[model samples]
Target: MVLILSAFLSSINQVFYAKWVQDIDPFVYSFLSFSITLLFFLSLTVLKSIKVKKSNIKLNNKITGMNSIVVLNIITAIIFICFYYANKYIEPAIVSAIEIGIGPIIALVLSLIIQKSNILKFDIYVCLGILIGTLILVWASLSGKSGIASDASFTYKGLLATFTAGIGMVLATIYSKKLSQAGWSTYEILAHRFYMLVPVTIVFVLNKKASYILDVFQSNWNWIILFTFLGLIIPLYLIQVGIKYCNPLFVSVTLTLGPVFTFVFQLLDPRVKWSWISLSGIGCLCVFVIIKMFIQNVGLNKEKPKGEKLKHA
Candidate 1:
């Protein structure tokens, strides 16, 4: 239930974010969003720590933990930039569909390599299905049969950006999972991430004149505030909480709804038109996700019997 809500919120947030980035530079946009979010989380963290006094919120001073958080923030920053640019160049629906669809596969491979985790044979088959679906999607987009309103030439660049963004998201998820397993609270982890991001964003914002930043805020105060809340704060909080309660792969899979939501939003917009080939591609991706979910459930059921027998023995 938490995962579902998180996925839904995240999906909606992406649509709004795609719209918000149209007038703002990606760097400037990210800086403002993260700055506000950082302050919000910082205040929350302080209040929570004060209430508990000597809470379990210990600092993870280990080199491995520190490295993970640092790398996670860097990847997050990169993803923000890539996704904003991709959204600018591509149709939001196509970008969301392809990017979100590809994330789980990347996460699975990264989990295997970094954690030496076992993979089910059925999962391998499902991955193949997803790959085929993704290929169909790419072909439909490249053929200019997609419903998205973008130039064919620029679509390729958008696709590349979305692909990189997906991989970066996967990496961030893996690192966040590691931090959760190592006894960090979601708030602590998120706070640290945004805190680290602040310095980098500050540098980016500083490169632009102060008046330009102020003028942007002045012109788009409502949008900026809404963007900060919806795109940065709420979705990120949900993700942190969802990841704390669920495996990263499961969380990523749940977010497969994001593209569907994006498609729905596109349909509501009078500017977009759906094509049969693109619809077929979307259908294929949905089928792939359904199969992946089934395989994961069956695998979990099989594991339950072994655990039961071990407990009885």
Candidate 2:
């Protein structure tokens, strides 16, 4: 249930993120959003520190997964930038479908590799299914008849950006799980993640120009605040909680809903048009995602009885 809610909120936020980044500079938006979220978490951290005794303060300072956390934060920043840029160049629905749709498969593969486990036959089959679905989706998006575009160059760049974002997301999920195993609380992870992001974003904003920061504040502050809350703060916290509690593969599979939400939202926008081919591709993608999840669940259930027997013996 928590995983579902986290996925739903995260999916919903993608729509708002796409809309906001259409007008706002991606770097500026990233900076403002992270800064706002960081401030909120910083306040909480400060309050907690004040409430705790001096002797206990050392407990909070003992960071266990510093390397993994740093890598995760870097990947997260890259994902934010890539997502914003991809949404600018590509239809949000297509971008979400291709990028997020492939994440679970990536996470599964990475998990196996990191654990030094032999790839199961089932894993290969599932990977083939995901690859087929992704190829179909990409073909549909690139086909001129599908209404996405005939411009190969533009579509290629968008696809590349979205794919890069997907890789970043997969890595982030795996590392977040690692952090959880390494003894970081979800709040601590979330706070530290943004703390790492804030400085990098500041550098990005400064490199663009000091004026960009001013522009972020001067331009629709209301929308910025709203997007920060709905698109960044809330969804991020939920995702961290979900990652902490759920298997990374399961969490990634649940987040496959992001493309579905993107499609629905895009359907409401008059500017975007969908073709039958693209819709079919999206259907295939969703079907494969569910099938993969079912496979994983069955595999886990089978493993459970064996573990129970071992314990009994």
Candidate 3:
């Protein structure tokens, strides 16, 4: 349920961005959204930690456990920086295919290497199917038959950045899962998730004319609010919750459902007029694969309970 909800929110996230982000400075827009999420999550955690303290909740995470979170934030910041760089050069369809399609495969390999787990033939096939499905969607988008339409030339620098973003996603998931295993509460995990948006901040600062940010706020506050809460924070919190319960590979595959969900949301817009027949058909097969993987993951994790729960979490 957590992963599904995360996927849904992620899909809808594009709608919020479409409504708001297009007009403003992308860097400023991202920074403001990050600022809002950070403040809300951090404040909530502080208050909850105070309340949780009086009740004698002795959560096991050492102060140093936050090291993983710090590392995660850095990686995430870099990933988005890479994504922005690549998106400018690569076709959006290719970008989507690379990042979304490649993420789970990275996770599977990471699991094999870091966890030294035995690989099942079935897992390989599912990952391949997902890759193929994503390629089909990208192909559709390129043909302008369905999905996102785009026109841009691919460059090696852009390709490198795309792979970086894709690989960074799996690495972040791994760290989140490691933190969960260390008994970190989901609230605490998220509370520090965006400690610093180093990449966005640097670019925003360098762009000078930073004063335009004030104008953006004055003009687009409502849209920014919607973008901050619904698009930025909620889906991320859900992803954290998912990491707390499910293995990285399961979470990775689950996140890929965004494309299908996005296609559904696009139908409501007259401009997009639903046309993902091929995408949806293959998406359903991918969904079945996801369900199978989820069932298997659940059975594997049945013995362990979530680390700690804040009423807020």
Could you tell me which residue pairs clash in candidate 1? none
What digit string (tens of lDDT, one per residue) describes model 2 on residues 1-313?
5655655665666666666666677778777778888888777767776786544444444465688877988888788777777777677777777777787678667767776544445555655676676777788767754434536787788889999998888888888888878766676677777656677667776767677678767777887788778777777788888888776666766676666667776666555677676677667767766776676556533223333431100
| Alpha-carbon runs more than 4 Å astray in model 1 | 55-64, 196-208, 294-313
What would the per-residue lDDT of candidate 3 be over residues 133-249, giving only the tens digit for each residue?
Answer: 656654554455653343534455666787788889888888988887877778777777776674556566576575777878778888788867776688888888888877777
* Of 1 and 2, the candidate ranking higher by lDDT: 1
Alpha-carbon RMSD to native, per candidate: 3.7, 3.9, 6.2
Candidate 2 clash total? Answer: 0
Q: What ranking of all candidate models by lDDT puts the best one first?
A: 1, 2, 3
In terms of lDDT, the poorest run of 10 residues in model 3 is 304-313
Backbone clash count, each prediction separately: 0, 0, 0
Best-fitting candidate, measured by TM-score?
1
Candidate number of the best lDDT: 1
